[model samples]
Target chain A: MAKIRGSIVVDVERCKGCEVCMVTCPTGTIAMAKEVNHKGYFYAFPANPDLCIGCANCAMVCPDGVITVYKTKI
Target chain B: MTEATGIKEIIKPENLVYKRTKIMTDNVLSYCPGCGHGTAHRILAEIIEEEGIQSQTIGISPVGCSVLLYNFLDIDWQEAAHGRAPALATAIKRLLPDKFVFTYQGDGDLAAIGTAETIHACNRGENILIIFINNGIYGMTGGQMAPTTLVGMKSSTSPYGRDVKLMGNPLKMTEIVATLPGTYYVTRQSVHTAANVKKTKKAMRKAIQYQKLNKGTCFIEIVSNCPSNWKMTPVESNKWMEANMFPFYPLGDLKVPAEETTK
Candidate 1:
């Protein structure tokens, strides 16, 4: 069966660490980082990158529109 | 190099799927982290872009949390006094009948300070869109109780939770406007999740489409959350909104233009 490979670029400084995308992701691919960004907020990162399906759920619900998604078929 | 490095190669321009809409400027939003205003602004920009109305759209921003709305979207904007956005929208639309006019207002500005203007605009059936954001508190002004604040819900003025005996019941603005003969379309929506975001986008698209018909007022009430003022994490605020806000301001269309009945 073919699989989808997904990746995302998070603008760390622009991200306000709302974590809205973390709760909104379907495959549990995102998580908050233990290290804070320059703004002292725990930014979101692709914790389970391989599990990403590139549905764009994180980007869709991100209040700041900071996450950009890329996907390919394998 | 590890296999992970090979996977990173897929992050190329060709595979890009989603990016910020060009309609929005690069300015960082002034809204508190996790506030609904950002998402709402994004959705509004997306709708205007999808309709190819960027050059023709004029947004009337109110004097509350989203007072700086003009800085975010790349469109013509007019800043209105507290609770008077609807009045501005009415005049602008009448003067320029061909342009797409909409007002973005919060609960404190709409349901409270601008109630008279809001009612008359809807009552007269002005051909314009009114985007009302109901967060139930004055988020920008230190969380004072708003007209739409839930009964028994706490605010700075009602620290013990809003008491109906003193503060009065929450205003159902959408329902109130739906009854006006001039309001052709009225719907209540939210942007808390993916499904809801999609639904709201559709609702807005229809409202925009109705604009060309010169129909009555198009009012969309977006029941939103204020995480910073509510003192909860962004995710928690959504859950609280679902439990408390949804019960009072249920999501769905209060009215929609008739398919063949209008033309």
Candidate 2:
């Protein structure tokens, strides 16, 4: 069987932790960090990177354009 | 073997599927954490980049929450007085007929003070595009009641929800602008979700395409959210917008050319 491996990089400092990406993510790959950034806002990070599907939904819905998505086939 | 391939290799430029649009400047956006302005700006930038029209595009910034729009995009910009973006855009488009000119306006600017300019520009079928971001309440002024604010919607001015009897009704500016003979294409869209973002990007590209053809004015109303002014979390604001804003201002095209209306 083949699988599409996916990953995402979140610019922790630039993320506003709005959670739009979290709700919009179909695979629940994103989670908000408990610690806040210097801007005093929680930031989003990938909690289940393995679940990512390279959908890029998070980046599209991100208000800050701080997330980048990547994918490969295995 | 698969485990041997590190993430660095998978994330190389060739493997990268999505990244920030080059049209967006390095400046961090001035919008609130969850506000839709950033997404809308990104979508606009992506369209410009994809169409290779970054050099030919001119944007007019409205005096509102998005006044700093020029800072976000790497395009020539003119800051218009409150509600005068359409008028300014008209002049730019007329002078540079070969370029694609557009105005980014808020509901307060487009529907209230600039109502005449907006209406007249569309009426004249100005060879330009008007991008209207309607978030209902006045987000920049700490949540004042805007012309598009929904009835019974609470704002600083309308402490109690808007009273239609006293404050008049929420204006359907998109619908009003669509009826004008000058407008070639008009649509209402949002950027709350990924699908909506894609749809909005398509609409923006189409508007720009129409401008290249020297078609009449193109109007796009973006139903955005104001999390800070709405006194709700970013996610909550989107939910509230979907529940409340959509009913008063439904999404989809308000007008289109006869050629595109076929079976």
Candidate 3:
């Protein structure tokens, strides 16, 4: 079994909201959170952890290099 | 007994066949052997290296064989959805403003599925560089019908030979896209032969340089060849492109700014 750690979080300050990472994730785990950050920038949030196939697409498409998904194989 | 090694006999530290820093990632390229994409990739890298733009450059990887460009481009790259490289380029260039943004796209990826994105990107006057590889067939997807596939060429999707009545004529994208008011520089080049490859590298460098100047959309369309999919050896594919696609697409710069234009 594989365990995912350090959830994929989008830094609102850095994210341009291109939505490219959302489209590339194969697992459909990430979503644009309804709540906006203090800067009013809508950040992409990981909605479902179990669905994440850990493709690293979010990391790849984040132009600002803001998203990071930490995983652990137990 | 070891004889005195001459300069010719010296092993010379097993001269690296491939440079580690040149590759985008250590992951082996998934392209077929003798693929022209390799040539295009090398030339782009050389330009980035020569101009010292690797740090300031942002590349949009397309959805064809070059889709995995992040594996070899050795710079910041974004993998765009199928046919969306141009759109991604537009967005990145608009947002970053300072970075050198370019999109690498194949024939089917650019001329077919992404035609709208490609055309609109140029029409909108986006200050971005577009490297369009028109190999006349979809090399990555098992040689399917591509927008630029020669009239008589046969592919997996058109195994009966491309019939004009059914498949439509091959698209002259460079000529079509050159007409866009936003496109400041448009050239159709090739990498079929050494001479052609050199010319292509020059055109590619020019396009990238145009982007650095904040020039409007500059498009360099390489009328490349897919030997593996064309069912011909590398030599034969070169001959075929020269014979068939060259007259159709032609090789030359279509538009240059008036000041930069030679009198």
Instruction: Assess each prediction's global lDDT (C-alpha) against the native.
Output: 0.92, 0.92, 0.73
lDDT, residue B103, model 3: 93
Better of 2 and 3 by lDDT: 2
Write the residue-wise lDDT of candidate 2 on B122-200 in tens digits: 9999999999999998988889999999999999999999999999999998999899999999999999999999999
**Per-residue C-alpha lDDT of model 1 across residues B188-226, encoded as one tens digit per residue:** 999989888888888889888888889879999999999
Interface RMSD of 2: 1.2
* TM-score for each predicted model, relative to the true structure: 0.96, 0.98, 0.71
Cα miss at B149, model 2 (Å)? Answer: 0.5
Worst 10 residues of 3 chain B by lDDT: B11-20
Descending-lDDT candidate ranking: 2, 1, 3
What DockQ, between 0 and 1, does each candidate earn? 0.81, 0.81, 0.01
C-alpha lDDT of residue B221 in model 1: 93
TM-score of 2: 0.98
Interface RMSD of each: 1.0, 1.2, 18.9
The 10 consecutive residues of candidate 1 chain B with the worst lDDT sum are B1-10
